[model samples]
Target: MPTYKFKYFNARGFGEVSRLLFALAGQEYTDERFTQETWPAEKPNVLLGQMPVLEVDGAAYGQSSAIARFLARRFNFYGSGDIQALEVDQVLGVVQDIINAMIKAFYEKDEARKAQFMTENKEEKLPLYLGMLEKLLVKNGSTGFFVGKSITLADVTVFDICDKIQAMVDFDKFPQVKKCRESVASNPKVKKWVDTRPVTEN
Candidate 1:
């Protein structure tokens, strides 16, 4: 197979799932990271000048969520039945909202604003999203995953999100979230996946 070039950044943020997805699918590729200074010169050279773009035999496709969904459908992490597949997609959508809120607030930052954004995140958005996920988990029987029997795209991304928050999104009002997060985080493959991924400043 012709190898792909996955161009992202210094951290796991958007590119982590692409990495995990590729790994889980048993596909081979080069995972490349770039600093901000280098992007200006390098990005324009890519087919679309954007990323986490996946290049398959040198044809490029952009959009992180699109990449994730496409890869999931291809690899069977999307769930088995039609309804289950849609459920897998729905859960992923909800999880993406939480991911984006934090990315908007903290990831793309000037050095000075971290403290203030962290306060805003904990006090406002974090709890709301966490609570929603916990409730969804509880509603679904807290089944050690978001969808059906096997791990899906939602499971992979949520596992990544939970690990991202350990240093920050503490369990005060959101204690139930710990159960949902722990269920996936403890999966041996997922634990190893998160541990191996490169840390991004974002």
Candidate 2:
């Protein structure tokens, strides 16, 4: 087995999904978390000056999605075949859209612009992306998994994002999405991680 070390901030943000992937696969890795104060000094050594870098043995890789995908494909969390992999990628793209909007709003220095971003996300982007997710679930026969007949990286990724924005999304309106998240949450290994993992604000 390759030795793994996942480096990210102390917060869940971009790092959580990969961590969830590790948990779901029952894989072991070094989870290296840095704080605001420590991160600046470390940033220079990172290839992309980003968090969520995955170090296998000594070689480093960058990007949260890339790291997550590597682990997912390695652990068989990616869907079964080519088409299923496409489905998983589609959902991951949607997730990236949602997260991009959130990150944009989070770092906005202008107070009014920040509020507008937040408002637009709650009123617009959330509904749009959630609807897309709901439609994808329906496309997959509403089996509570995004692709194939079992949990994939897509499901876990959706669960992590939804859990973060639960307050904004109306689950009653998106029953399929709700069901999918619940299915992932109820997973034995996933539940253990959720129950035991460090509590963060996200």
Candidate 3:
């Protein structure tokens, strides 16, 4: 079997999705976690001088998003048709945008600024992106799944983002997002993924 080694911060900041994909695909991987002290010195040897890089058969692959896309394609999780694949990619992008906005809020100077960002996040970006998700979901005739009416890379990516957000924000006010997350969160496979997954905390 080809060897798979994933190096990243001990946290799940960026590497979680690909790791979960590996699990769901029933693939064995070497999950190597590192801290700054180790990463700065260790990273130079890799392709991009970064962690979260995956080594498959001694070939290094950087960029978390690209790594995720590659892993999804390998595992049959990308989606079905061209349109479905397109929607999947677009949805992942939307989720990424929201996550980035929220992370910005998390790292700001004062509580007031952080709270302001959180408020703006809940009021603006959250609904803008998640509302779109709700519509696409309903358009897909969502029987509680995102694309192809089944589990796909998009659903996994969305679930992780939504779940991570729910941990920080009060998402109850956004029922569409809450419902969307619940749908994905409740899936047996996904529920198991969440249950066994490592928390992205220090």
By TM-score, who's the top model here? 2
As for TM-score, the candidate ahead, 1 or 3, is 3
| Better lDDT candidate (1, 2) | 2
lDDT by residue for model 2 (1-202), tens: 7999999998888899999999998999998999999999999999899878999988999998899999999999898888889999999999999989988998999999999999999999999999999999999999999997788999999999998888887889999999999999999999999999887777
Descending-lDDT candidate ranking = 2, 3, 1
TM-score list, all predictions: 0.82, 0.95, 0.86
The collision pairs in model 3 are: none
The TM-score between candidate 3 and the true structure equals 0.86
RMSDs, each prediction?
A: 3.1, 1.2, 2.4
Put down candidate 1 lDDT per residue, 63-147, tens digits, no spaces: 8888888888888888888888777777777777777777777675676577677777778777778777777666667776777
Name model 3 segments beyond 4 Å from true.
Answer: 110-112, 168-180, 186-193
Per-residue CA lDDT of candidate 3, range 21-71, in tens?
Answer: 887787888888888778778866888877689999989899999999999
Pairs that collide, model 1: 11-199, 11-200
Error of 3 at 202 (Å): 6.6
The per-model lDDT (C-alpha) reads 0.74, 0.93, 0.79
